[model samples]
Target: MGFDSFAMVDWSSGNDTGPRPRKDAIWACVVRQGKADEGPTYFRNRELAEQWLLDLITTEIEAERRLCLGFDFPFGYPKGFARALTGSDDPLGLWEWFEHRIEDSPKANNRFDLAGEINCRFGGKGPFWFNGLKRKINGLPKTKADYHSPFPERRSVELAPEAKGSFSCWQMGGAGAVGGQMMTGLPVLTRLRRTFAGKVAVWPFEVLDTPVAFVEIWPSLTLGAAPEGRIKDAWQVEQVALSLAGMPIQDLARHLNVSAAEEGWILGVSQRKPNIAPPPLRNDCFALPAGVNWTPVDEALGLLRERLTVVTAAESLPVMQVSGRILADDVFAKRSNPPQPNTAVDGYGFAGAAPEGAQVMPLCDGRAAAGIPFDGVVPGGHALRVLTGAALPAGVDTVILEEDVTVQDNHIAFHGPLKQGANTRRAGEDVAEGDLVLTAGRRLTPADLALLSATGVADVPVRKTLRVAVLSTGDELIEPGGTANPGQIYDANRPMLIALMDRMGFQPVDLGRVPDDRETLRDRLNSAAKQADVIVTSGGASAGDEDHVSALLREAGAMQEWRIALKPGRPLALGMWEGVPVFGLPGNPVAAMVCTLIFARPALGLMAGEGWQEPQGFDLPAAFEKRKKPGRREYLRARVRNGRAEVFASEGSGRISGLSWAEGLVEIEDGARHIKPGDLVRFIPYSSFGL
Candidate 1:
């Protein structure tokens, strides 16, 4: 269905504690709300804006025309935050709480005092920070340096995997901060909702397609909305309004079922539209060690060889039981194939070559059947009965049989022409003795097992299965089944990595979690070194105060800083613990998996006695376009759609769900500045990485 009007409010804080018809207030644009061209009005203060919005919405409702209104501030805070603030879990209650307490007027307001009052209710010095005025309030600090919030700095919506350059709501006075706008704006929403009652609907918090709907809009998500000019915010509101108006009604219907209610969603971003425009390309996208030579795909394999040594310890197992095991040494044929020349067909055998124009031959007294061959040679001009795979008698040069000759009472008459050596076996024709069938470093497959059995080989020397121990680091992580505190979240990386290792044919040993304590973390690594060939860990690899993995390795063993030139996998740390290789992956789930596949997978292959292999890449047209900076390679979680690689909308490493949503990875080459739609991009299917 078509909306009768598209409306948006470009909001402003206006004044700290007062409301007047300020020069820079709110720009309300209501495009053609019912009866044609009735809105696109401006408001000087939030009170007038709310009154205008409510009146316009009321007019549109009476006309029975649906209106879609977009707001420029957050609809809700982080999950559980609103629930903590209000007795009820509903975010509407938070709005009501704000509305009941805030006092708004034309020339003066109590926004700062109101903020301080709200903070005082929530443990005295928190939840709201930053003051525009020099006057000090009891709870609200006067400066950013003095501000200390008891509440989280960011909301759950602000922490979305790909939602970048977001402002913290707790910071109320800064230019980019949305805290003041939320404080003043939420009251307007509450008043509008109350005045309009059943006529107004809020997105994510309410079902879509209502009479009048409100949605949170971010102008930045719409690329190209602003013209390149010296003047900023000139046509942003108009262009964004048009963009939302032009979007298909069917696409708008998708917002009816957003998953999380406590933390609202921004318009135009969805799970289905993975090929949406990417964030502005910056030089920081290329993350790697500065001024250091980095290797490309092929050269990286060689460098990996130079850095890592293959495991030498070998074990012998039956060929049938070594399906995925790599061979330690060459496998030779135990016996020659065919052993001796056997009869190719069932026919007669004779000692002499074929005679010209001879159609009849006598039946011979000797008969050669498989495993019951006649010892004597057949007489000339006589035929000997032979079966397939039967050994030939001495002086028997040819074999002719059943189909070509007619036989009665042991006497056979040749009906067709006889040929020499047509149905007889020759010794050792297929395989010579001691032929090397399979070489070292070859992983045994089912077909390889069959080939070995056919050659009379029972067992083979193969590299032992790599024992990979997985450990999850960080104190904030708790196991999935266990209870967690307010700030704690269940460990996602460890489960994902453990399952990945299992599917990749490695014996994964669950080494469990290591707390933030340095001594405990070191002790866990020491324990892993005793039982594991490779210790794979997530978190505690970065140079943060809580990270102890790198320091432990540097003091106890060895550490090599590759700092790979790749996106989503750049923060990889490689080290050794008591001669055992350890891979310190990024804490972010998405980044850890990418690093595991491209870096750790190949290294493990080398340890398993296989050659280093670069996961193959496929070239396809890119479905999305972006301005990029050239330095390191980038991999996007993407899917194949209509022959194009559609990347996931988020570039956030924290979005773990994208991994399951993507079918493959789109690889961008180093030194490429931009990617345009229809540009051939190298794609690596998740299957290629054995993920």
Candidate 2:
């Protein structure tokens, strides 16, 4: 016995049709499935529309969902449905009262469409959502015009529960509402600001641009009582009611508020998408550029196991046993920090009662300095002034500073106030027994060392510095000061390597440069392996006759891997020499630096007990205006400029200047060989490798 509902879409009605077009009308039964709207019920005329809506609702039963009828027409007639409900002879007076209540609504001066409003209300009421044309009141516009557009042109005066003042809920049609910048032909965005506020929203079709997009507004209805303004068609209204059926009535109102805001009716919104996690990296030996995406530098670090190998003092020296080493353990107080109370100011020590305001002078007694205890007691009413940091005399609870009292006739003046226990440092004031003194992982700064010394802790446990022996091989390499003979290169790698190791907190033993002789190389490698925790040799891992470092390391232990599919340092080698990790880098300066950063830097930090380290990479638009075929991954030596990172002009792999001028390396993957200007790219820092 609920209200029967029907939907009428008058696609042809417009300004050209008549003074007011019955654009679309719907008469429906608002039940579990929606209004059983059959055919056109309200488009014939306003009086007929009201009568049809009244008939639909009057025939309703006491159902869960409301029984209502929505007509695709305006209800602001000469005698509105409210006047009829009031049973008053003064219909205009009733309208005047209603107008006063809804005085905030915008003026509606133009003809409206119904179907379009139904579409927009459901389109996800973003800022561009439109309800309906502003209907002028008394030929005067409302001072504070509502920025939020009106609802559909549908009339619900009769369908509303019109017993008293304002209907708690009402059903109306929204069609031909204007939305977006152009306010063109788009369905109305039926917006419900508050379900019980008595203000219903309707949009004309002329406001929106997408019909199908309008249905998105149903979930946003929070305040209004009816769904007819948003979804007018029989099936669509049924679907909307079903979607919102199970939700709490209050929750429905909240959702409407959110939708109204989304439709751009409200101010302050966020439409930007959130950051997405990068796709996973490939596990293949040669990672394909498009196989998967690399994770963020920080997140990617989780996959990296620490390269640290903790060797004990029997094998490796503890940091505490060595000077200038970082503290590995926290040192704490066992007894009171001060141990016992002492004088805070310099003066004298005497035991005996020195009454308040009493002043008695004693002849110069033997001085009691710091670390020296006093056993003598002063005579009654005698005072003892003590120096700062001096031990307090027994039976003496007070020490008066010299400035507080005067000495006359061998008796101190007693005008000033005498603090009974002034200037005294009680035992355990600074620190109590067994308190935490220092924590582990301290870097042992100068102040830290002082604290340790103060706490009587000289020897402490610390992470042992990894001993690194740097070696450079190649007959063409000469010492820095040595005159370069023909085909001889000044040893740039040695100096660079030494500096790199120093920054990494390594005990670098400069083994100097050695010729690429098989016997000499083998002996030097053995000597370094026996003494150093890590051994690095340059110019011998590549495929060449003089590249004998790998062979020598193989003689000592197994060679893990000879090369990776990387440019500039394809022949880099990872191997063990006498059980010591050995890195064999390319002879070229740039290649050596790159290899060190990518492979060796993390290893050294691990050995030092440092936290896990990972390379930081930033994406920049490529500055170079060129293209190349995509295939192998390339690390271009580049410099950042004006927010864009550009490859170095001297990009030759063998050019030493490239490493010096380059801020970082650009990683190219996924068959992305050719790069265009302004393309985003990843730049890896040179210092990331401890370079």
Candidate 3:
């Protein structure tokens, strides 16, 4: 059961210590519902402490709040001790026995005397030991040297690895001893349980359905060192109470499911390391400042660019398989293209300056061809037969194209104006070794692969493909392939979003359609968060009765709705669900597609490690005239015709056919404008957005 508040008490078994707030005195802290943390109130005696606790419980119960009250002492004895002392195995029976025999007051208490009486009943040697009094009792010893245990030294919970530093509950009257405190504290708890009969229940021993549930706590289990100038006991109870109150309801419920009824368990005993899911990278990256409303188009875009970051991890893949993947690291050329100088064309090689006019030279002994270099060098004023792609041999400075020369008797003749070093390729001319070829965040293309392959790059480091889950929410919606009733329409958003994501090289997880029920939408979102890097839901995004998508995000404290100043689309919901970013779009098909293209597309590209993608636009003559408002920017579904841009016949956002009829969008800036034919306007094609 979840608790509305928490109260932790550090118990003391000593006499009336004066009111200076010293150590070893009772300190109780209460963290009330929706209120600031209450003080670690000091109590000099058990009577005063019990009265203060009962008053707090009364206040909480009157307010209708459930309280998880914890006390720093053992609530139950070791397994067999309770059965032997009470005849039954119930631990509360032992509480009753202690309640009837124990005597207490402000001046002193009978904790040590009771321990001696219990020891005398069990053969007079003992499970309980130690005495801080000047005179020793008959059965209780003053030290461990004379003590003998009839029961186990520790409970099962004390042996757990997380509870390693806890002391044995049998050690009474010494430093770190809990036996004295347990003997004194359990009786007061029994009275509280009896006085408030049905209102209070002990955890792990009874169902925690009452308004107040009592549990055992060991402050040392979670406490660090106390701060300077603060009393250690006060610090411990305050910090422990705050920690318990801050835990998630679900996590706090897990701590109450232990099975140590006969030998009570300490809260948070075996749960030092919880099994909750790890949050995603930069989980709060999409958070917006509170009170932000009516954001402009430019401001919204800027916020998206500033807040989003790459969420995908990188890995190395073969160059051939890296196409369409974003580069995670910059790539350098391992070897230069045209690694060594070679002939650019099939020609004759020579070693001489270009002749002023027609000139002829004797042929050399060897000929140069592709992949077959000439073994012999040509003499001055001599030429050798060479082919395309042949490396330059010694004494070769120029090549004469075979088509431009005449070959007679193995001698080539070429005309003047044939510049020196003409037609000969230079080493590292295309790319130099160790040159920065491709930068990180670039989407690898087929042409880029060719460049990398030529530069000796066999493997490329690229980011893993981002998975985007697409969902459509509305009770009035059904899948397109299924038959639709009169009140239901075929779901169009999911298929459109999936196709858009696939075209952008993202893996689209089809989450199908969800109804308007909040719980059903919540379940779908949770399932989507596990498998997708991002989620896109196209309906229930606004602040309407059926808008469960936005409502659920708000419930998680992660929703941000932006009333953007843009036509065709306005309300855009941005939030995180279980660490995965979610984009909530309008239910109308036209607005959904428009918002996805304008906002979600660039944001998703940034998250996919592709950096930010801005759609390219061109200015063209307007083919129609219209007057636009000044407060919001407008995008009209348009197609370019004969050097002019013509928008769709109607401007209504619900006209789904207009989206299919247009090839692009004509953007009008956020200002009043009287547009007419021949006026130039910016036009962005669907291809520019990778449609």
Candidate 4:
């Protein structure tokens, strides 16, 4: 069945441009069943427009009519962008990702900075370009001439013959840069998806099994010339909405059935073949291959690295403010370190290459101190009094330390046979001008800041801090300090995971806890997608009846159950929640902590632009012995004392005390063997995992 109502929104990403109806502002129109077309409504900002739309949707829902909503901006970027930006090829995931990163208000927004940030992820070249900001944005170029897109310039839908004149979503400004409209518009869509939840479906991506469907539209496709008195944006939206609403049910259904899941398809662009149903949406990038059961730890790690890419964008910050940030592009010295030749110490400066015996030279008229140059050059046989960090005067190639020379009257006496340029700092001695000071993907430290500052780099381009949301699920869980009823236990995983993320330098967003209800978990996850780059949940990861997290993900067609060949933490669920990556760990505290450290740590690091982090381990003599089984790797909570590794007394997954007791973990490889007291074992300290 087709929609009974149609709404078209001509969106804008700009500020509240004032009360008068004008161009470059939001214009929306709706045509409802059994009613004349309503509203070519004008809104100054997205907030008002969104509220009005929401109210309209509520009214339509009450009337038991389905709505087809359309927005002007592209719903997705060109193919491959979603995969590159969010580790998934699903455009809706990109929508959720943008929902979290883009900050929009009436008067101001961070679209330019956000666009540049995305460009920075592509090494600061660009798939996005053209800055409209008064000041410079780090990776975003000011003109199309400087752009070098790593992905295609346009989506396939935009290239369709009927859509020939449509603007590329990559162009950010200077005439028809729909990219700004998209950056601001997608978040609203994401919010609408959340607000509507189960009742709404995004066309071309999900099957239209809901009461409402949202699709991308180009008003120009159906609108001819506007009436002379009407604002073009308003006229077009009204006309388009009415046209779509008036179409035959069969024709509308055909339009709705066409698919382009990765790069969203625009309605009315191409004709669909009769009786051929559109293919189902492509499998999410996180979905595992069929028939794969238990995966090895190494294979899991490899899969994570292969599938995940940086989700956070980059921003330009002052060098002093960039410490602990990952560098987005290779930084070059603006000018050389020691910029020009200068004195290394308070001394008498003169030309070198004099006689090998003791010599006396007449002094120049003035002294050269730091930031103050001597007025005149030093003559061949003359010296000038110079202080430390003073630029060398012309005709002077060396300096004799004040303590090494005897100054009397207008002359200084010192021994010759001195090396040329001795006691004089050379230009570019530390870092030459235009030399690469820091490479891309490097995490800046305080020392790195000093080096950058010394090399005349005032600003640094760095990846934005990755924000990870921690969630815990289980009906039996309660917050700490809460009075627990029968069967309920305190939730330990949320705090532990949040702390772990913080310790690893990611911004952790506490999503608190949700009980074992699928709907509640779904709502929480939808909300999390708007606030975090990744989600780490400690429970409901298995396929058990109460495992709502994994079950909900599977229902959404994005879940992969990886029964890893490891003790304590075997059921690891990897999935996507509204496009945001979700890592599902075991319910037991010990197993949850182990899976997170062994898997999520390195994966999150890569997504944060820090690249993969392999925990360093050292072989140590075993202080405890046990028989090991083949086909499964194992990690035991252990502490080193007197050069030997000692494991916890119990290897139980429920022992939360062991996490606190151990200083490190002793790893056992997948093989059957008897580990004697003197056997060598690989010990990885907690510090190595950034504890």
Using TM-score as the measure, the top candidate is 3
Candidate 1 similarity to native, TM-score: 0.52
For model 4, residues 1-691, the per-residue Cα lDDT tens digits are: 6778888899988889799989878998887752336468899988898898889878888888898888888888898999998899989999999899999888989999999988998989899988998899999999877569999999988887678889999888877879999988898888988998998888789988888888888876644445446787887776567556545455466567677879888887774456677545666322333433356788777667765679889899998789778988899999898899999999888887666899899987888999998887677878888899999999888888888899889888977778888888889999999999999888788899899999989989999999999999988999999999999999999889999998888899999998888888888988888899998998888768998877765543333545677876867887666556789888888988999889998999899998898999999999998998676789999999999999999998888999999998999997887899999999999988888
RMSD of each candidate?
25.8, 27.9, 16.5, 21.3
Stronger candidate by lDDT (1 vs 4): 4
Each candidate structure's TM-score, on Cα atoms with residue i matched to residue i, is 0.52, 0.40, 0.60, 0.56
2 against 4, candidate with superior lDDT:
4
- Computed on alpha carbons, the lDDT of every model, listed in order, comes to 0.73, 0.49, 0.84, 0.83
Clashing pairs in 4: 93-579
Q: Ten residues in a row with the worst lDDT in model 1?
A: 223-232
Q: TM-score for candidate 4, please give it.
A: 0.56
- Encode model 3's per-residue lDDT on 1-691: one tens digit a residue: 8788889899988889997889989998887642326468899999999999899899999999899999999888887998788898899999999889888888877888888888998877788889778988878888877678889989988988657888888878878779888878899999998889999999789999999999988877655446446898897786567556645454467678777769989887653555588554555322233432356788778767765679899999999899999999999999998888888998888865686798888898778887788897778888888889999888897898888899899777778777788989888999999999999999999999999999999999999999999999999998787888899999988888899999988999999988899989989988998899999999888778988887676544343544677788855677767557789998988989999999999999999998999999999999999998676789999999999999999999889999999999999998999899999999999988888
lDDT computed for candidate 4:
0.83
